[model samples]
Target: MKERWVVVIGGGAAGMAAAVSAAEQARYLGVDCHITVIEKTHQVGSKIRISGGGKCNVTHVGTSAELLEKGFLRAAEQRFLRSALYAFSNNELRALLQQQGVATTEREDGKVFPVAGEASVVAEAFRTLLQRLKINCELHAPVQAIKVHGQQFHLITLHGDIVADAVIVATGGVSYRHTGTTGDGLRLARALGHTVVEPSAALSSIMVQPHSLVALAGAALRGVAAVARAGKLRAERQGDILFTHRGFSGPAMLSLSRDVANMQRSQREAVHLAADLYPQQLHDELEALLLQHSKKQGGQLVRKFLQVSPIGMLLLKSETMPYGTIPNAMVPLLMRQAALDDEVTFATLSREHRHQLVVTLKQFQLGTVHNVSLDAGEVSAGGVALSEVNPKSMESRLVPNLYFCGEVLDYVGEIGGYNLQAAFSTGWMAGKSAVNKLLTAL
Candidate 1:
């Protein structure tokens, strides 16, 4: 039998995983198969190196069900990702890293990171695995186009052309172009008769309309429920949120930015952001707390209870009910919004004043969203439409022997390690399916 070649484009998480899976499968099958990874940049795993502020959150620690519920919010995407996620799970990925001498630690929030605490360690582990597997990795080789010639795939690159029996397009999305992901895979998929979902920014800080909150830049609120509404479309997320000079960022804002971006595209209506400073407290419960506190500490200044330091407030749990805190800087802002004087005490508080205070705290407006930054996005949303690809194998339904995985696909997981996990699982499936297709043909 001839030495069949499998060429994988890009060297990010998905492409590297595909190459490794293909090589391992070929070795296990005792076939004379050669695997090649073509990366446009000089180094592989550029995204991994910068993810999680360089800590490289490897994967989230959870079962498939938990991951689906938390990471994938949409039913269609969850259904599509079920098989791949179950096949090559977070546990299996961690185990693979462990086998490559990369120890991992799970944080209290279920985020997994390298014990060494440097992203370079994780990237180096993949490089070491590739070396041990003896897979050929061609750096500085950017594929210009892929021309199909019957059973063979001719990949035209900047350096030269390489013919392969099968190809995996994991070139990723347009976010972080400096990392070498510049929508090459999306263009290729479109050229090959696949429907491409116009890519948008996901997990990016939102730029809000200029308002008083701009002065509170660097202030943050923990575990707040934020809701963004554009026209009739509404999206909500609960987590930590930071006040930026332009608008807001952090887990909650970043997660909901996807919907904001989509809404901007769908309609011309302005997007507005509102947050519940006390998400855990119901309106009636919070109102009662205010009333009860007034009776107990009638002499307490109104400013004293509402004030939070600029450093922000952490979660405070009492014996029965919990209290959520807002930024100290927000105290004056909220007081102004409620038309209350800072010198006023609970003893002098009127019925209307108390009601207004509660209402202002519950629905604090963060202003309108002006834009979602694609360049600043952690990952790009939208890609090759899921309908054109097979989830079980990560193979293209329209083009045999062609496959896709990672950010190039339309599915976008929430903040955490879900996106990386999806990349690995789908990449593994694609690689295995390509090998199977070749073996059956022979």
Candidate 2:
């Protein structure tokens, strides 16, 4: 049997998975093949090592349908990810990690992480798997360019040139340049006649125009419903939101940042983000409660009224506002926004004032969003267009024996474990497909 060479251009999550899957398939089929993973940085899985603040949210615990509905926002992405995600589901991933001696735990929010609680454990698990499989991994050797020469690929790297029978490019995205993902895969894909969509930030914090909310930095609201509106277009997300000194973050804000960023690029108008502090409460219900408060606690100081009255007690007992009466700090701000003074009592509260308070509470505007930081994005939103790749196998539609996966493909899942799971599944598909193609040719 003739020995064949397989090369993976990146050593991140997708590249590592591709290498492992290819090796497993080759061994199963008794193919004489050698696999090499070329990483430009000094380490492999740099992104995985620092993901989830070092805990490494490995994947979301759910079926493919649930993940598609919860994690993927766009219909096109859901359709493209259907096959790969179902083929290598979350349970399959967990089982593989468990087999490698890495136990995983699931959070209440459905994020899965290594029970060891160290991201290095997940990275090390892959390293161990690669070592056991005898796959050659070359670090600090970046591929400068890839050239096809009649049934072979010549990969020119910093160290030397290597020829391979098949190539998998999983260089990830341009965000996190410190991790060696400098959009090399997109460039590589473009050179091979694939369309590369312009890349931008996703799952990133939105920097808003300076506003009163800056004073409330570090304040977080639970069960908030946020909507990002630009022109006639709008994007909505529901979850907890954290106020930043300059902007907003947390699950809800990060989930909609990509759309906001794209809207900012397409329009000159400023994007406005509005939040409903109590999304579960109706406007009429809140107004009726306020009316009752005014009638019952007529003589109490306006500032102190909500603290001791039915409104506060009602909100406290509600399961949604788990943070305990809206962060005593925001009450004053809310009052100020309603044009009420500190000393005014509920007895003197005008109907106009009551209506203003309801408006402010029901539709609190964060501010005008100026930009979504690409450098700070957890994962970028664009790459080689999905239209140019085969969704079933993750192989390039125009190039034979050439494949793409991970952030290199044009799909950005929401925050949580969706993106990493996409990387793993597509990578496994690409690797398996490449080897199967080789076998067919042989």
Candidate 3:
């Protein structure tokens, strides 16, 4: 019998997992299988090397099928993921790292990271595992073309061409091209008759118009809520909002950006982002507090009380109020108004202050998104259309002996370890299914 062969393109998290899973499955079945991984970059797992800002958030703490199901975009995709996630939960992944000499620590938010605080450790674990399995790794061998021949795949690389019985396209999406995710997988899949969804940036920063209030850059307002509205539809997220020189970031802004991006794309209008700095407290509470404080410190300037929150200070400063002149009565009224209304209106800070306070605060809207820069993206949204692929095998319905895993497929998750989890899960299932199908054919 001819030796069974499987070729996995790309060597990021998905590719590594697929290659490893295929090799392991073949070993368990007592079948001779050659598993090869092709990476365009000099090193494998480049994206993993920089994931979580180098801390390498491997996976989230959610282990239940339902919670894990919430991570993917489609219901069927989530259902398909359950088996792989169960096979390798967060606990199991952590244990695997421990065995590889990399200890993991979980944050209060349930994000698991390596003790060394470097994504390279996670990459090392994958590399070590593949090495132990004797998987053939071809780094810097970027595939230029893929030709499907009857029951085999012919991959044309810069070095040369190689034929394999099965192929796994795990080349990821078009984010962080520097990390070797250049959307090659999507293109390759498309050439093979798979429908590729136009990719967009997910978990990315929003670019707001520059206002003098942008001076408040670097200030993070925690526990603040932001509502991104298109028309009747709105999405709200309450988290830390960080002001950046360009626009806004942090969890709140990142969460809002997704809806804003979608709205901007569909409506072709400026997306509205309203920030409620005090979401928990009611207008009456703020009004009462302000009234009490005003009476207690009748002589003290409002600016002094405003110093309690940097946002308050910015608001006062934007209104052109000198440090000592703002009245205590006005402070409470402003707070009350901000708390009561979903949108807080601010008077112009200056006749021509260059930063429109009202525009920056309440009407802080941004025009249609020109383009989401790939380099700044956390993950790429959209890939191979899920309808054309079988959820059970991650294999294309249009093609035989071909599979896709990771961001290369039309699967994306919100920030956290959701994307990584999906990649691991899909890769594992695809690997096992490919091996099973190959054996069945034999």
Ranking by TM-score: 1, 2, 3
Q: Which stretches of candidate 2 lie over 4 Å from their true place?
A: 305-323
Candidate 2, residue 50: Cα displacement in angstroms equals 0.2
Let me know the TM-score candidate 1 reaches against the reference structure: 0.95
Residue-level error in angstroms, candidate 1, position 412: 0.8
CA lDDT, every prediction? Answer: 0.87, 0.88, 0.73
Across 81-195, the per-residue lDDT of candidate 1 in tens digits comes to 9999998999999999999899999999999999999998888898889899998999999899999899889999988899999999999998989999999999989998999
The deviation in Å at residue 137 for candidate 3 is 1.0
Q: After aligning candidate 2 to the native by TM-score, how far in Å is the CA of 133 from where it should be?
A: 0.5
- Distance from true location, Cα of 195 in model 1, Å: 0.5
Ordered by lDDT, highest first, the candidates read: 2, 1, 3
Model 3, C-alpha of 66: deviation from truth (Å): 6.1
Error of 3 at 99 (Å): 2.2
